[model samples]
Target: MEYVKGKPYFCYCDGKIKQYRYLDKDIKCEILIIGGGIDGAIANYYLSKDFNVVLVDKGRLGMSCTACATALLEYQLDDFAEDLLKHMTEGEIVLAYKMGIDAKGKINNFIKTQGNYCNFALRPTFLYTNSFFSIKSIKKEYEFRIKNGFNCKIFDSNNSPFTFPLKCGIYAENGGGEFNPYLFTKQMIENSKNQNSIFENTNIVQLIKNDHGYIAVANFGEKIYCEKVIIATGFNWEVLGIDDLCERFITYSIVTSPLKDFTWFNKALIHDVESPYHYLRTLPDGRIIYGGEDTIFKEKPINENVSNKKYDKLEKDLFRLFPEIEGETKIEYKFCGCFGSTPNNLGLIGESKIDDDILLFISCGANGIINAMAGVDVIKDILLRKNNPLIPLFSP
Candidate 1:
């Protein structure tokens, strides 16, 4: 898939930091990771700690979907827990929610270990509903989360954030945060450099399964022999014939110039109950990044006119939510990227049904960063030949 168009702010901020040499020789390792995005980096970080690992990407690392990501590290799934209960048993739903929540903590801990280099900041999240009819459902969701001992509080319109038309809102404490995804991916790769080999501009053209393991042939005919192979290519997993696992869509986002007066409520990560909900966050430098005008994926190149219309909608919505910064804000960046959506809003992680020696760690959904963090532990346990309890929860 054509992952992104327009300048992704994070990429621009980081500039061209470093470059890796392309692969020119065949290599052998205990584990081979294809794709140098966030998932691949996380996998490399854990697997390299104890085994020989090789990570390769067709292009620059973290320049694809990872760079374009909004990077909201929240445990709140796109599908609420109360709604999931309609399809799954209470125990199943609770476990899934707990896993998501635990993923947030894991992410925090991992960031801490890395010296919090990714602009990691713990913040509150507000899931609100503007419609009166939606209030009851939102209240039910709030009650369900609270009943499960989650940190949540319900607020009526009278006490909700100013400028937000809220009938009710769920203020979740210690469940969400934001980070610089591009930096996180790069740091992970750098941290693993000692124990792992990274090959850039090397495409794995074919995979051959042998009796003992798998052989991945690169574009230049350089083969990688490994006991296990992992695919973390995001929406482009069609190269591995697993694109059908999740539906793809396009989402737009805009980053504004530093505002003179930031009037947003506590600068908390804010989202709504509406479909294609608008999400907004404030950077430390006083800039606001807002995203969420999503549509079904189309195979055409990014059209400037279409992108402008989407940006207009996003800008208009931003003004409606926070009219205080109307004239003061100027959009500095606008971009659109393909986002993979799963049925249950949880990431897909496990061994491939068709290929036994191959593992899949596709983080599909809004909680992708957190899911990827969770997946690191799961994949590590699998490599160690230990049973991961999350296998059944996030199974492919």
Candidate 2:
């Protein structure tokens, strides 16, 4: 049923949709997708071209972490080069850099050709810190990027936009980009739907053994059968019996009212070396999103109420960047979200040992956009490594 008559709802918050009970029914599909997150959307895109597909969402599509996100799209993960390099070996660092670079193409290909309305913007990206040692090391990082074929430049505190401290900022040479993740992800979901099968506002309760493949037991004991299953339901793995993932909280985010464009910032994504390490960037509509309040409790966050602490911290953080905003616009909306993480900080993409052909996961920290695309191709090629040249490089 088309939802035109359906009242408009903000699925970003909990209790937005009616509690759906799964109807017990016998249904079949070649592939069943459990989560409606970005990774699930991308996986559905690839599989829809060939296999029969059925996608179920516990929450509205594209409105979970993807909507609540700070939405800064950068190749660099939480740690900047200076610190990340220390933890990584030579070959590992090279592969990591190459993987991020390759993710760029997978995400931007449609933007380059299909003219997607997803706010794809080109801006400069910078990393800065208060320590003199950290400031001087950016130059070394710039040198490393150039030596390794990445185009980068260095700017000292005196030479950079913010006048806070002594370190230099490593410019990403127009590599930084941002977009409306909700809109882009929603478009993909729409394209993934076909006449064969679809169910929304549906919640899967359990997974059980079945004769053909697997049986997804929804809330009301409804049975949906599929030959395979992929779990892209961000932060909801517990419902599907993945319990160990419930404790990992990788990062958090917040968005502020649009700030006046400045020649100083040069409209690029920014990350700094603070206690919680602030990462900031601009949305297409001019809002500035800065987050990374790291180092805290590990328990799952109970954020049913808006965080006054996060709001107050954001104000103080941005005031350091734009004193103008301190007296002007206040934070209009705020939400706290956490993602899954591992010790190595790389995505875990492959088969599940628990059940046969019953799982795939998108475990990258926040590189969902590009990683999702690359993962779709990798999952497809996993069964053909002997014949395919690129298969061994990404094999499980």
Candidate 3:
């Protein structure tokens, strides 16, 4: 069992979660899933192969925060040394890094087999820090990345293009990619349905540990029994009435033109070397979208005036590169969500203390697409009662 956030358990849905109309019936399966976001959907996809699976969500599959923005799928470690030093030892960082890389490979393989049209293309991801202090750490992480069998390079304006006033960056190749989040999530939904594994627009109201195993009751008083429950509810975990997750970190993001013809560079993904680091990549249609810069808190500031204001500033920043886009470019979408970050910026995985039969899987500081496969590995270890790469590190 793990320590849970000492706060009331409840999920608060934005307009998205509310729009879903779920079935009012009782269901039973070997694994009962809560939340239909990417993490939950993918978890169901893998777990259902051998187990009778049932998934419930407050909204449509992948329609929530998962489909709201462009997914920058990459395994590039952002501020790896700093993050590693704070939450884990160097050895642990190395292990986690390997796991991320392996997870990324697994996702790519799955996409290929499914013939998904999400534009899951591989490219290099670069991380830079405007601060001089990052130089040393960047060097350390770069070495660590390469030593662990990754294709990586270290950049200081002097070696590469000083095209800008950037200080230092670590560029890792073939470890990252970009995709159309909505389409990708949609494909997974189809796959799950074909397998007879997905329950769409189903709002799970409660979970109780019964002697048979676990019972999942939906909004219409419908109930289902299963051996275990997996919760990947994203920002709404607390909303599930789970007491262990109370400290939430909120973030905002927007999408723009894909990085197709970069009058800027040949690469599709890049980021500025600064705190609140910004990661940008091009979509299939050549639209480049950037995200990062989060302010931690209890609730989101959802107002057109406030959102547009931040968007305005971000637009101005983009103009500095393609001055022509000042008023030429228009926003295609806007999104905001809370991430459940652990003290170490790592995700919390494995069995939950609240119920021995429940497994709590969370995605916070890191990118989900790349981490999903690693998550599958954890779930497998839990089910098989065997040792997995991610179990020891993530188990509560």
Candidate 4:
């Protein structure tokens, strides 16, 4: 569906995984995951430990939307607790926030044990705004965090430690993380228990229901008989043939060439309160990865003309934020990829509405990777027929 466009930074990074063979023969398993992006990698990594799982991708793994992900693993939702109250209760909001924190911990633990090949590191999170209209909302979010016992410091213009202008903001110490998304996807897939079952360039042409389960026919006529299926194709939902899965958007990003002595307070993950807001962080290589400026995705193959304009806007925005590097730094990478958002800022991570046997592991919103990391447990609990408090929050 041409879900991604332009040269993505992460895809060109080191630690790329070796290619997997296509489906040359029929296969069978307890659960069959139909995508090899980061979402599918997380699902397979966790679920395969308990269930018989197989993962297949139509193209190379982590080369699509996963490559373009900004990888800002913050525990904060796309919307504040105040705004999410319309769709979720106070308790649900708190739980979702906690889930985000726990998800970050999970990634940390994974890196600790699996080795930090993805350049994973925990960093502080800075949510700020220069607009006076946003101060109240940021304060409300800060108050919510305080009420929920999530330690964070609220900053105003007088107390701000950042170089950029800020009327108000919230700073949570080590409340977020950063990593190479493509490498992390590879890490998860290589560490997964079903390593031998992973396949690439195997497109499932059709899913035929059978007495036991369903038969997934590959493009080459090979078949996979599985009791359950997971569709983790990111924002590309054409495989489902069911539109309106979620509100889709094309989020743009630009990476700057390494600056010799450029940095912000604690090198924290910084995001603004502006609608279709912007985010920035320093890479391990001293470069800056900045993104946002999202536009609704009405169709695929992301328009180059629109993308080019967005890139221009993003470059200008970056310069506006850090005028010191305006003339010195040059943008090295420009890319845009599709992502989905739900009303609750949570992912569609449970059973499909059409059939319970068909699961959806699509992680939406800004904190998608975090959502997927924690939501995998919800999926596992469902597979085990156990109760999970997060089921209602992330369920499709």
Error of 3 at 125 (Å): 0.7
Tens digit of per-residue lDDT, candidate 3, span 109-159: 879899856667777777776678778877877777777667787778788
Model 3 error, position 11 (Å) = 22
Which 10 consecutive residues of model 3 have the lowest summed lDDT? 1-10
The TM-score of predicted model 4 comes to 0.99
Displacement of the residue 46 alpha carbon in candidate 3, Å = 0.6
For candidate 1, write residues 113-210 as lDDT tens digits: 87877787888888888888788888788888888888888878678765767888888877688888898887788878543389889999888988
Distance from true location, Cα of 269 in model 4, Å: 0.3
lDDT by residue for model 2 (1-396), tens: 111111111233232222233334668888888877667777776678777888777656665666655556666555555666565664565566666667666667757754666676766677777676665566666676778887777777557655545466777865656666666666566655443455566788888777788888877667788878877776656765665652345344556655675324567778886666777776655566666774322444444333456656767877876776676666655555556554334555556666657655554555555556666766666522324332333322
In candidate 3, which residue ranges exceed 4 Å CA deviation? 1-21, 147-149, 161-163, 193-197, 238-240, 243-247, 257-260, 300-305
Best by TM-score: 4
For model 1 the TM-score comes to 0.95
The candidate maximizing lDDT is 4
Quote the positional error of residue 11 for candidate 1 in Å: 1.1
